[model samples]
Each structure stands twice: as structure tokens, then as C-alpha cells.
Target: MLLELIEYHWAEDIDEVLLLLGRLDVKTVPLAGGTYLLGLHDDSIESVVDLRDLDLAYISEDARGIHIGAMTTLQQMVDSPLLKELFAGLLARAAKNSSSSRLIRNSATIGGTIATGSASQADLLTALAVLDAEVVVRSGSKTQVDLKGGSYEHPGLALAGVVYKGKHERRIPSGEVQLSRRPAELIIEVVIPRPTLAVGTALMRVSRTPADVSLLHAAALIEIDAHTYRKVHLALGGSNMEPVRLYGVEQMLEGQPVMNPLNSQKLLTILQEGMATFRPPADIRASSSYRRVSGMGLAYRALEEAMNVASWQNVMSSERGS
Candidate 1:
């Protein structure tokens, strides 16, 4: 129980929420799903401004991409048909991997996931990264924070802005999430742009058990031009402090041929060299060397999956055109 609990305010709108947040002391915070907030017994927290009453929950799209409200639950995103079609269900797949229990997923809000920086380990972060997702933050005005190197907190209430790619864009953006100081005051929105090319994306993870967090995981999105890879997006997590894009490896494979089975060995070598600097932790899950080796294997497999999917997509598109 919160021994320091002093007050609970249920805000009706963003304005009221913002006003309440502006008056907060160190002991105050905004509450959303309460999945993460209520579980904490920190003595420093004296009050919680409940945001449930505010109309912050939503799942919509614009010409750019899909926009998910701060209050939107992981279960909501997983059930979104638009999201499934936009990135070939990558978001839904990652959301499923975010939490195993249906009850927990039903209660966890997107804002909470991002504010707590849980995205670092959540498969959703890697999926969003590949889609070039960004966080929309609002205080008095809205500020679009790119996911790459994005970490900020509003002094009072803030809004989330998520900008996604449209169906005609090629380049995917990147972003990052971190633990914030005043998440209650910040409005959080996640935006992900749709890839415009014929691309295939896949997610692969390795863990001690199905319910355990990933120890070494990788995700890939590859755009194919005939048999050549025109564009590649690759990310790896759970093998380091935070998930990171394999920019060097991506560069090497951007224009390379992957349809040939013989290239597998060469591609694996390139991936290993690219991750040569990676130093995974030796823990109960696996040894450091095992994690490193397995991470590379996962990356390679993810790429192969993506390639197969892209090839299928290309063939289907051709059939439709003909």
C-alpha cells in the first residue's frame, strides 16, 4: 500500500490533467493503467492523478501512419486489424510477445510501457523501430520526438505524438524510449509509418522459456528488388544494454543478393563481424558467447524469413498487375 497516499484526482480532460500536473510536487504523479504505477510502493509518492477519465485512448490512422493513444492497451493494438495490415501484423506479434498473460496485457497501457522504458526489452520496440516510429509529446504545444535518441519529460502534462510512414514512403525512421521523470504530465502517442515497397518483415527471439523475457532476439524487414535486397532494417535486443539497429550489417546487405543459398555462409560471416563488438551478459539463460552466437543466428534466420516473405509479396503483386 502507498503509505504516503494523500489524494486521488480523476481528471476529466487533458486540460484538467495538465493543470493538476502543473501543481504536482515530488510526491505526485499521473496514473494511467496503474499496472506499473499502483504496483510501486515508493514512499516518495504521495498522490496519483488518475487519467482514466480523460479521452486519451484511441487507435486511428492518417495519411502518414497509425496513431495510438497513451491510454491504448497492448491488447487493443494486438486486436487492431489496421495495425495487422499496415506492418503485416508485426505490431500485433510483438505485442503478444510483450506480455504472456492476457490479464497483464489487458491492463498495460502504451504510455506506461514507453514511460517506464520497458520498450527496451519489449519486442514491440524492435518492431516499431523497423517501422520508423516516433513518440508524440505534448505540453502546451505538441513536440514530435523521433524514436532515435528520444528521451524527454515535460515539466507538467504532456501529449504523445506518433507519426508513422504512409504506404508510399521508402525510408523508415527510428526512435528510442527511456524511463521518464514526469510521465503523468506527458501525453504519449506512438506513430509508425507504413513501408511503401514490397517488403517482408519477421521477428525472432530466444529465451530460457516461452514466458521468460528474450535473452537474445532479432527482427528484420527487407525490401526486395527481384532477388536483390534494396533496403534492409535489422534490430537486435536482449543481448545488450538496449536494442540497436545493425546499421553496418544493413549497409552490407542493402544491395546484396540473398536468394542464393550459398550466400548464407557469407552473410553469416558479415553479421558476426558486425556484431563483433557486442558483449552479451553471461547469466542463467546462457553464456555470453552463446548469446552472441545465437543472436547472429537469429538475425540470419530473420533475414531469411523476410526474404521469403518479400519474394511471395513480389510474386503476388506481379500476378495482380498482370
Candidate 2:
């Protein structure tokens, strides 16, 4: 595909950007970091709406939880004190490990990354999915999309955007759910709710080299009460279009006693059995068989680390009481 001339509009605010995108005559796309769009030589894009001036880059915390603006870069996430302290630094670790290149990390916006809907961003997506992050989008009105929950529906009205939500009764098989967004809609922010219970998280990835894209990755979030699992979230990447939540594995772990050596083997057996049905897409990076096996191992390790963090927190709580 050869590069074609395209009109560039530097928008002063969100309303301007939205207005430009909502135009019916010409095809327009939002530009944040431009990392995702620059690679695409799509001739259909008639105009580019520059969003850098919209004042979307911000990270803040409140009673609701953490709020990260759309234009916030990966490096900002990595350096955030709030992210480093929250959920055992799971988000920070994911952001740091997302790309070995400091330049890429500095330029890659979280919103743009999620917008791409690419499976290659497994590490970050897995972490977000496990954390039940909500994507706030603006079309005409704001809609919050929950990553864990299935698609959002608005009867009679075209959906402006859709995002992940946690804990749905009906599960999508293989946890393959895409963040659906219309061209006219814009993602404004991501919200991660504050955990009510003691929470621990872990992230694991397998790549050929330190900087190489992960062949597979897993992220786990475990909430514990009285040494029993109160809640569990397990997400895997590289097997599907989006990060897959291992609901089967999560269900098995929830309400179960914290993993002990005696029962660890049994749990591992269950985990392996649950993962057997996973069929990762074969690509130049690895075979389907290898990804499947690696997914299982990575999920298990991530779960183990989460449990360890939970246990340590319990011990610290006890010590404080004494």
C-alpha cells in the first residue's frame, strides 16, 4: 500500500474531534500516538483528527478508583506511583514489559493500544482484563464498557462504544471478546475500581527474546478472605483476538482454600485439564501446540505469584494486629 495524501485536522478539544469524526462525507480517524495508525496504509482514511491537544493525558485517583486519560502513555503508566502501589504493581509491570524500547513506551498511548484491538498487546490487555478495567467512551453521551462483561447493548440506538466489564453470568468461550468502538466514538478514560477485599496480582509472559513480542502471556488477580479465595480473575493472551479470561480456571480457584502443597497438585491437574481445550493461533512466532502449553504454564505461574502476594499481605496484617 502506497501512502496517499490525507487532510490533517488539529483539534483544540474533544468536541471538535468528535465533530470531525461524525462527518458523513469523508472517512476520518482519531490520531493519538499514531503508532497504530501510521503502520496502516489504509486509503480509506480521508482525514486525520489530531487529538494531542485535547488535554486527555492525565492520571488521577479518587474514591471511585484510578482514572487514566486516553492519551496517557505507557511510560507514564510505568512511572505512576499510584499504579506501582495498586494491585501489587500489576499495571506498572505490564506497562514496563509491554515494550523493551523506551521510545515505544513513551509514544504508545494506552487508548491507542486498546483501540488497535490487536492480540499482540496481550501483556497489557491481560492485565487490564484481570483488573476489570472499564473503558469510558464519548460519542454523544458517555458509555462505560466493562471488559469482563460481554458486549454492551443499547436497543434501537447504534452503540457508540463497548468495553470490558467483570463477572458475567454467561461467559464467552475462550474469553475472546473485542473492544467494539465505532469510528465516530472516542475513548476518553479507563477506570479501575478500588478493591474492597485484599487483592494480589501477577503477570507472566513468554517471549523468544527480552524485547520480542510475547508468544503468550497470563495475568492473575486473586482476592482472598480468611485464606480462601474470595474472587479470582485469570487472563491469557496470544491465543485469540483479545486477551482470554480463563473463567473455568478462575471458577475452580474461587472459594477454594489458598493453594497448599498438598492440594496444589490437584489444582494443577484441574488447571491443565481446563486449558486443554485452548487452541492458540499458529503464527511465525510459534506453533499452536507450543502456545497452548506455554499458556497453561504461564497461567499457573501467575496464579501462584498472586497467591504468594495475598499470603504475604495476610501475614503483614496479622503482624500489625500484634
Candidate 3:
């Protein structure tokens, strides 16, 4: 893999990267771990501004939330106590399945993958979406990261970019539903957080197998009080542009009884309402109709699993006297 014609620049600071970015696209690109980006051998990438020397790979926690330096390796996150304690399922699961191997993870950068934006394997987005993660992109002397933790990056990491400090979902009994096929596959991560009394369900699944991209995905957070649902937040990925929030479905669930898996008929009905609103893109992976239908199914399953986790936690804590 000798990049015979390409020259490598080991940049140490922001200004150094920016200077390189100002240059028009030639055979140039930025490199951190050189995991994915390096795989593509473009004739234009004659010079790679290596960012490994920037010391961007580190994980720290404070009052705000976990601050993951863009350069942090996947193994670092997989082994992080902070990640283990906070976003237990997502970090551990996504790290293993998101890429091809541990060696890749060692070379992969959180910033790199995240900055790629709208990747077929939308792991970090789901993980952050579950926890209401924020993305920080820096340019010039100023920086703007989404405070609401919305998806979509500014595009172009080659210039001067950084994706940093996204939070994880907070777990409360009957709080949010997190659904994925294998806890160890490259499936989307979803979290549905409730406003209060109701349950939130985040549904994520791949239409094809482990090696394929997820055909359907969703995240819905609702509040339930006395079996009555309220303040629902329904968001879907893999359909529409970026991810879409289902306001119509949320409106329907406002006063309805929480459909916690057991009520298949009612759950299906709500899911139907959700499917009706979707106009998913058709591709070789799956047709629009299939993706729409499966998205509903994933939502149903995710809600059920979330409830089970809630129930399990309640029982465990009661027994432990915590």
C-alpha cells in the first residue's frame, strides 16, 4: 500500500491543518487513524495531511458529559469505563460491528467516521441520538456544533474539521427504548426518550444481514403516566433526507395508552400511521415499501424491549435494595 506519488504532512496544530485546507483539492486529504479514508486510492489524494500528531484522540468526562476527542480510537471507546457506564450497549456494540476489525478500530477516528455523515453504517449518529449527542465542527476562528444534537455535519473534513463531545441517553425506568438486531452488529443505534410519565422507544434494524446496511431505522421517545402516553418524540433514519421526526404519529400517541409490545394490534396501528408518512428511497438494499414496513416493525420491537429493560431494572434494584 505504498502511496508512491502522495506526500504526507504531519500537522501539529489547528493553523497547520487550516493552511493545508486552504489549498484547492489536488491529491490531498486529511488522515487521522487512516482507517477508512486511506482505503480509497484516489489520484487526487497526492498529499495526505496527517492529523495523528494533533493529539485529538482522548476521552474525558466532566459535569457536561463525556468529551470524546475526535481522534479517540474505537478500542479506546470500547474499553472506556465512562462509555461502559453511560452508553453501555451502543459504544461496546457499535465499536465491534461498525468496522471490519479491531485493527481498523485501532486506526479509526471518531471524528473521521462521524464527519463522514450519512454513512450506511450510521452507528455514532444512533449512539449520539440515543443520548442526545452534539456534533462540533470548527472553522475559521469560530466553531458551531449542534446544541440540540441533530444529525448532519457541515461536510468537508479535509479543510479543518472536528466532531467532538456527544452525550449518551440517560436510562430511567420506562424511559427510552433501544433496539438493535445483534448487540454486536453494525446496525443503527436509536433511543426514544420520554418527557416524563410515558416510555420512549428507539427502534433500529437492518433489512439485510450483518454485512448489509440497515433498511429501516427509527427513534421514538414518549412519556407515560398511569398507562397513558404523552409527549412522544418519533424520529426515523434510513428514510427521507437525513432523519425525520414523526410529528403526526407523536400527535396520535399523545393521549393513547402505551402500546408496550403486548398490544400488537394497537402497536401495529400506530406503526401503520408512521409508515403512511414515510417516503423512503428505493435502492438495491431494499425497496421503499419494504423499508417503510420494516421501519414500523422495528419500532414495535424496540418499544417492547425498552419496557422489558425498565421492568428488569426495577426488579433488580428492588432485590438489591438500591
Cα RMSD to native, each candidate? 10.1, 9.5, 12.3
Q: Can you give the TM-score per candidate against the true fold?
A: 0.80, 0.85, 0.66
The whole-model lDDT of each prediction reads: 0.73, 0.77, 0.54
Between which residue pairs do clashes occur in model 3?
27-44, 27-45, 27-46, 57-71, 57-72, 131-168, 131-169, 197-224, 198-223, 198-224
User: How do these models rank on TM-score, best leading?
Assistant: 2, 1, 3
Off by over 4 Å in 1: 24-26, 119-121, 141-175, 179-185, 225-227, 239-241, 257-262, 281-287
Model 1, range 241-279, lDDT digits (tens) per residue?
356788888888888775654477787888887877877
By descending lDDT, how would the candidates be arranged?
Answer: 2, 1, 3
State in Å the error of residue 79, model 1: 1.4
What's the TM for model 1?
0.80
Question: Which 10 consecutive positions of candidate 1 have the poorest summed lDDT?
Answer: 165-174
Model 3: per-residue Cα lDDT over 96-132, one tens digit each: 5455467877777676665444542544445455445
